[model samples]
Target: MEFGFARHMFVGALMCGAAAPALAQEANASGAATAASRADGGGIPDIVVTAQRRSQSLLSVPLAISALSDETLATKGISNSAALATAVPNLQVSSPYGSTQPNFSLRGISVANEFNANQASPVGVYIDDVYIAARTSHGMGLFDLDRVEVLRGPQGTLFGRNTTGGAINFITKGPKLKGTEGYLEAGYGNFDTFKVQGAVETTMVEDELGIRIAGNYEKGDGQFRNVAPGGRDPGGVDTWQGRASLRIRPGNGPLDIKIRAYAGQNRGTEAGIHGLEPFRTGLGFFEVNESRVGENQTDAWGVAANISLELSDAVTLTSITSYDGGKQNLQQSSDGAPIDVLNINWRSTFRQFSEEARLNYESDKLKLVGGVFYGWDRIVTDNSFYIGSVLAPGVDGGFFQHYRQTRRSYAAFLQGDYNLTDKLILTLGARYTADRGRYDDGYAYLFARSVTDPQTPIATTVPCAGAPGSCAYDPAAIFNLKGRNNALTGRVALSYTFDNGLLAYASYNRGYRSGAFNGGSYTSSSGINYVDPERVNAYELGLKGRALNNRMTFSAAGFYYDYTNQQVQDLRAGPVNILVNAPKAEVYGGEVEASLRIISALTLNASAGYLHARYKELALQGVNLAGNDLPFAPHWTAQAGIDWKIIDAGSDTVTFSPTINYFSRQYFSPFNSENAPGTGQINSELQQAGYAKVNASLIWVHDNLQLRGWINNAFNRKVYAYGLDLRGAGFPYNFLVPSTPRTYGVTARVSF
Candidate 1:
């Protein structure tokens, strides 16, 4: 994690970007069409995308999007959503607390605090057209997926709620109407890991009905062995999931229907933290010193239905309905030491239901899509914390909280593209959304200290019934709040496509994120229960094209955003953080992506992103942070890779792929202080250093069979993925979550 090493890697990536064309030239000098060339037919494969609500070639789409196919996922060892950060530019995903929750940021725009269930994310996440409402479930297994699409701009039209920072769509493999196919894959890796995945699809009634089934199971030992007395192991994966889908289409009819159901459960060790005690412990990376039993258990299930009807030769009507729910129970040590002074347990449940209908019309000169959506969500949570004698004398007690929240939303949108000429097009889109939220009967209490208690002691009544100030939480304390807001967002664009397959476009979009209540742990107090909505107006210009007769593909874009009433998370007191609205902010960035098929046997890919994000006007608690950089906003992010095919024949092929991802130094907190620990600093000196992760894989393919051996984090670099400053809580410690260590594994797969 040295600065010198990071600089070298960054320069190397730029060199790779410049050498792609030269490599293509050298490949042309050799006159033979190798077996690899014959396999690919001497051209880059066209990728189909649905970013614009329609099926089109990726090269013709006028947006900044990064998409990965199923094949690419397997070759790159991208097993979960967090790993996707390595493949996409200007995108970051992390688990600040544990593996159960995932936080995503696009272009330095993200939810500042993710600990509360009532907070809404600016980035939208969807699965099979159904918006995922719970942040905890965003880390679900990525099995049997057709594609993962990331749209990097404001998506206000023809999409669900809160897309101010863009959207991520997970498209799963659906049932086939005319064919039967399936695949089985199994793998063995480090930490005693064993995993299996299988998927099958068949046409039950020959072009009329079809069915598909998929399942996944993985289990392993903990990554970090516990060395503390009475400490439990952490970082183990024990989960299983299954999915079933059905497709019904009457013979040659214009109507089609799809039904899908899925369920998953996990019971394993929870996530732990490593405290940075440089002077005493000398950088503890993979170990946690805690005297508690860590447990992270969860259950999730959902169902969805999609109906499409062709009203005419040029028009179609579609209806989508979905229901999703998840439950979690987690317990972990919060002190990151063996003192047993602090521990947290959270039990929560979430459910959401949504319905959407859209009308689409396509013709030679015009394309139009309009939609209306309605959604309802509910959450119930019970959180408690334990305090021991080590932290406070005769103050050993637990704080218990219970709350319920419900939200209802309605939205309508319209978008159209009109071709003014054969190569010129004009696009216009708009959406209007209204949201209503309510926090029902809620209460909390703190129990009296018990000297002989081995665990948190629960009391039936509040210990401080009349004197509420003596206890952290009280049953007499009650909160019933409601909030409502409405917004109108839109987009406009102009585009032109040349006859030689080059497309360029310029666009402006306005998007908004809904207002929310601080209804969870921090709402028991007065005057800080609600925060205003956030809005962003973004401008983007982009170019996408193919050169060398479709052998090389490139995309580039520049963007700027104006933000208002931005929601910022801040800590007011011990264990009480509130979301506040900032006056204004500005962010600007650019990105470039390129892929060159140097030869039939060799291909090169590289991408880089630059960002300059700062707070134009922000004041909290009499402290001005107008000139500070946003949290987790890195100046540069780059990735480079090379794919080589050693042998390609009718029945056999061998290939190797190596990739490296680099990220510049980034501040984990907005305070951006670089002082020594215990210096009464608001922001700990701990920052995520610039680092690189090297990954490689080798594959052997024979007709319908394949074998892959891969290594991730090949150098076993001690990189920090997440960090938290806890100086305000009387503990001068910075907890760090390290990246996974080097892991090598072998996977075998077969297709029929």
Candidate 2:
């Protein structure tokens, strides 16, 4: 059957549906009255998510769900999902292009390179049932969202075929009727940042059809100072987005359909994170006139459709199918510094295609779910150039090259839980997938050709670009290789619910990440050397509960991961680039979360996490990198916040919140044998210092009119977290990517 909308009735059938808020249960004085065995929103809606590729409640799924409410997002300075990783437990995010593009990871299992959009992210990010495909795909996806759910664990059950580590799903707001409502917000902050966003929704046919549309635009200056010739000045990132959606519910039937379309673009500087020098057991000292490099321009868009139908009193059938895709072409200079220094330049472009189709049937006794998924990605060109011989900086040698990779994947799964009794439940799921991909590498250079004298030859050099012995003039050189791999994955879970709203569960799951050949120096030739996919077997225990009559909720989980034949970055004997598969490894971590409402208008929330990710064993042709700390993995993180309101307000309500976030120190450059001397890694910085950030915001609401102001990183602390230097020309301390600094802005919003 065609899972996508039917040709003849798709549009018409969708315009006849109605949205009804969740049917709330009656409550008693002690707060028990607020317990929601189900959601309390418009229409008796089902929480549809591929958490395990099934439609289930946000509370009962044995796994952990770190959900951020739409109401909460607006109150805080959180404007995008990428900024959420650090706020969520055990979840971490990193970006190359800018803060807008984030690569997500859970319990510290992130894939090293995301240059290939179609390849897989250790953690999958999806929107409205459609899998996002470009490396730069969902960077601007934070606007006009309903809620965001971050699911942590090896999701081998049901989802996009390539979710090996975890998954994040962004659910947008649907059509709401009975009231013509929408809001417009405009603000100006640090770096001369200017932003505007607005939305509107009204009933077109009373209780039958409804439509809503929203749009946003944000621009700011380059934050860092780049004084180099051909180098861009700091503080320049501009972005914007637009979205439209429609809802239809058939009369006298348990059916509803929602369709949405969205588009966004980004154009700015792509400053690679700056690197740092080892502390050398000394105090902090500084330098003047540092800069960053490169320029980036991107465009992305997609569409999604969801259909829900109740077949009977005990069964409901839901189908969600969507086609989503995008592309990004970016050029950047890596580690160039000290204004006017001719340095290394790199360029990359990616295009991706993804699709997912699933069928879900739910009943009081048991839930049956199954689905099929596939995705394709092509990283057509990845080029990096060095202005001089890398090791011997003064030698006049230059080289440029490109690498191409294509990753294709397919998967099938069956999952659900069967209730044995009112308090006991059994959950199980299985998945199998076939994955294949290839890597192509090549490079060309312009430099002095070196040779040994024919007799007692001291090294002699010519200016020929070809024939290895002459420098008079010649051009180019190439290298090649090929690789292929396939694998199967699965998961199982069990949980028990108490008389109260508390649940406990245990699960064992599998995760897989496809591997690829290395293109060190960006010049290796084409090869199928797509290394074998890495696999993980995880064991976990979790607890989920609702207290104070559902006014307060708490959830926690801990897990241990065992990996076989792990795929990791390996520096070759000569520092030339390449990736390899290791024999085995063990990684572990845990996360905790809690949310509570102290009073009708006051609430408190906090989350803390810890992870110990290391290489259990490593070998490069038999030499070992065992016990090495995994790069970029932080050991500890915490986030907490509180909300307060002013009462006795006539038609006017005021709310304020202050938040704190922290991350422990993490290593960026390898300090172990996993990376020996010659590989480009040796000179790389050792570790990125951990730091804390504090932010607060104020909001006033007065019927159709709202005002908000915020200041982030209030102390103006300079973070060494993402030091990126385009002006230092191999200078130390480059991982210098800056979080917004003491930014403050006010926005006026109106709704009609």
Candidate 3:
């Protein structure tokens, strides 16, 4: 559970990757030259990525990155953003609130336990070069996607919005210029899960215009058996999504434009929660006793337009514009008991608009890219709490809060790479950003009335402590908080390429995250409403190479981060949650990824990540947890897999692949407590033990058709995704959200 072990393991992995080829075969110039020339002979296809805003080889990117292609995602059964955490190194994903709002962490940098609708996350999410500012919609389903790229460190230069932790880019397939193609897919699994998807694209006007359309629908029964008295289904999902695109090539010239529109709807029951004492009482893993099982409903839609003009072979201009909006309604029980002590209902809606323009120039000696970005968004949220059990008999009472906020941001950035020598390159990037945020209106009040009274509760919408009807709304009271700031961030890198396609690079980057208003009811208890920006300075060294006649690829990186003004969730006198700035923190880690083709029919893949994140100076309330690790940060994460083509027909093939992922024990809270003192009872019920799971899939492919049978979490291991301590809210125990159990399914697809 300590960082010392992780460090040692990381060094061992690096040594193994660096010396493997040398030890396996003697060094020879002729052999290295032959491998460098075999670009098409590989275990996996060459992955081209846009991590730096341009198409390039994945291995050539200077930053630490992990990529998943459409085929890879399907084979691995990764259908959403949250599942990506299990496949990538140094990454962890959780849904403390629900699956619609996922929280992500990379290299020990994360934002946990803060759910203010107006506060943005440090981890940036982008689709088709447009930023998604709300966490609620970041967990977009993966359908008809080309690939997904995860950049592990600071991305403050090109991606300027809140990118202190890093960025995730979801790239979807686009329309073909002169082709008529499509695909159909269907799947069935245990738990009554069913899915169907289809896509089509055609050239409406030969080489002048093209159109594409796609859609997906999925539904499944509850993974957990709800045993609550008189409770309905509590853990099921129903979702549908649709997309359309038009690609225009005017006069068959160099001017091209694409317009894309998409919409999605989700309606499902909330996740089930288990009490801490349930396990001790010999109950099932997911059994719960609750009188009220809440439901979740959401609607989201967006449109994006992209225009590209090739002024010359060496220069081009591009423009991107987008608008996105979403609304959500959710209600859930807080204590997970039949006699509910607290129930919460949350309603939220948000809208955003963004515009970006870029220019590019490239030549044999130098390449340049620059862009300007503007974004605006408005968010509104309402939270209502029903506390009937805590009030006097027949005296139903509760609290209500409502808030609205707006944010505007502008940024300009430029990045260029120049060849210093035939073997060395220098890269420089810089960006300047200005941000403004305002809390337009906020209101809160308490209401109490006798339940026996025939008349309903006459609750006022305005904030008032005096008698009823004597209340009024205020714009400048204590809630009209405004914040503005400017920041400059950049990146510097030096890379060298050898004649044998080997690359080594070192980089330094400064990252920034903007401040925002905390739109919540906490102001009534703690008088806190605003949070400050956070910053990070990072250094990295990396190496990438191909060997064994281009059949094997290897990569490794080591990084260090000096973080200041780190934002964290804190508890005040009323035990109310709020966002506060931590003085300082530090994180250092290393990771290695490798893929080897043992033979033309068999391949092996492996990756490992290590991190040691700690708060160098932190004081919360009266407790000082200076050396404690951040929540959700595990010391080590790793995965290994093998793909074997057991049978090969002239025009058909059958393959089997198995993968196993492992993670060290992780703490869900800064306290890092595991068990009650001098007892085996579960006291610090907010930690997950070290565990591993195995997954396997068998696939048959013939021409343009495929059939697959897969099983995930094969052994049905019991794991917890998140936890909460309910003792402070008059509950006698804690609660845990259980992870999905074993699932098996069959899928079929056809393409023409």
Candidate 4:
């Protein structure tokens, strides 16, 4: 099935490429201005990216990358993390804990359905060059940004930590030393949603120091309706975040420094889940019958400092230091039912510190970057689960699990690019990483109805130290475990630039992800056992260029990966979820993105992707999962959009932008079960069928003021963003999280 899809995509890409030049030529014959002459008018604007730790033109970089400017973000209505997938090809974001935590997957490489806050995602996320270590904090810091760059494939050399999938860099706007400037925006939308975002910047000292402050606040009544009697609706949105930045450059000298501090909190209702079983509820997809409504509360903050000094004409030294911490107290009804089948309260706190120093040297023929990094992080989790009402009808039963983990990482990396000739370059990079961690203070207590009290449940603690059948806990569980790993990873590539302004490249990379202890353990310590690290060897070929006098710009890439020891969360292991290693897997994909200026008043853009990811050798107990598709990996993804300048006048212009995105069928679990007897379905309920969404925006600019109206998911397509199988827990249903429905709003912004 996947092979045929790949062939069709390849043919379609070739046809599009063949037709673009003719259209551009026709536009040129109509006396349209060259793209370089009217770059800001309608042509595809040039983008500068820092994918290689240095500022370079996106078209010159020999890698698969997609960059979106702040203007594009607003025009496309991409306000949050999940919306990013709609714009970038082969990118997926799934959030089990609502908008608080999002797991990013690039090209079929992802963490699967692991809801543990302590585990780091294979896809590395960064903000202004500072790596975010915890997935809980990844959802924050999306507001008031300059640009977002998504680099596809393995980023093993410069970003050597856990970039087995890829990397996303969210570069925020900084303070400019040019007087005072600011912008303020406010909007109201459906579900009684109100939003306010703004940023202000000022110069503290002439040519020496500048300061910037930015913030975002949003509140809504929620979209999910609860149909159960006297049940309050869930899925509301209430969150606010703020950031402060300072930039210092004494006498406009080579000594540059930037310091930033940010904080945010979410106090909204928890995201609602839908049960797949017919007996659970007869409510609609957007209606839930949850009896116990919960709240999603989280507090996060971080501080970072970036310093750089020029030592010589060709040498520069840079240092980055950062500290981040967060706390989360979340209550959830996992069963999505009126009865107390599965209720959970999660309490976790995490802290991390990192320091990195690197030296960059640039000469006429060679460019080099070398760095050493040291990082430490700790997480403590105390979770309580209530399953008594479902397991034993009248008896109150539950368990409390407490665990703590401290991890340290050290690494040294070096990458250099040498110009073999005027148009040919050779790139080689390597890194050595050592990861060490200790998991301890892990224990669980099972409780039931007290003997003295019949109506109320009391603390009837039973530890795993008791005899067989005495407690519902695994006896062979190890409460304390230590793990260490040392490995080497690198990248090598050769790129050539044509005189016609085209860049072609081929490269190979080795990526690695550190082992981790499962933080979702509840019944037994064995659930928290150490899982080995995963590795991947990736190869890629790519092209980036322009056609028909630079009116059309495009990038294309094809890649393949040899994966081993992929970590996957196994929920079929009796009563407790375990982190197991998939012996082997294989992945291959291709993507093409292009933009063309049809005329001075219109620009058309499109992108398409095809991925094939499957496990080659995987078996658990007696069930074989070989040839099953990897989680969150869709076989096909596509997007088409247009930017039309319908009106243009002095100090006044109007633009209308519309986009459509599509995704093929994808599974959320690794099992990819073909039959679910409980639901009488031919396939697993944890899968989402192919779907498409439409988004559009209209903006009118008059002098320093701009007004805009936007809508997302205009067709109101019903789809699932995430899912979990509960059959192993003796439940006859699957928990599913739905994507946002149709939303519309209008906003006005004033700039100075």
Top candidate by lDDT: 4
**Per-prediction TM-score to the true structure, in the order listed:** 0.92, 0.82, 0.92, 0.93
Scored by lDDT, model 3 comes in at: 0.77
lDDT of 3 by residue, 558-654 (tens): 9999987777666554435556777888999889988778888899888889888988987754457689887788889887788899998878999
Question: Candidate 2, TM-score vs. the true structure?
Answer: 0.82
Better of 3 and 4 by lDDT: 4
Candidate 3's C-alpha runs over 4 A off are 1-12, 20-43, 276-280, 392-394, 449-478, 522-525, 674-683
Off by over 4 Å in 4: 1-10, 17-42, 276-282, 449-478, 572-574, 675-683
Q: Show the colliding residue pairs in model 1.
A: none
The whole-model lDDT of each prediction reads 0.77, 0.61, 0.77, 0.82
**Number of clashing pairs per prediction, in order:** 0, 72, 0, 0
Poorest stretch of ten by lDDT in candidate 3: 449-458
TM-score of 3: 0.92
Best candidate per TM-score, number?
A: 4
- Superposing all C-alpha atoms, what RMSD in Å does each candidate have to the true structure? 4.1, 10.3, 3.7, 3.7
What is the full ranking by lDDT, best candidate first? Answer: 4, 3, 1, 2
Q: Write the per-residue lDDT of candidate 1 for residues 189-238, one digit (tens) a residue.
A: 99898999999999989878999999999998777666777767677889
Worst 10 residues of 2 by lDDT: 16-25
The C-alpha local distance difference test score for the whole of candidate 1 amounts to 0.77
On TM-score, the stronger of 1 and 2 is: 1
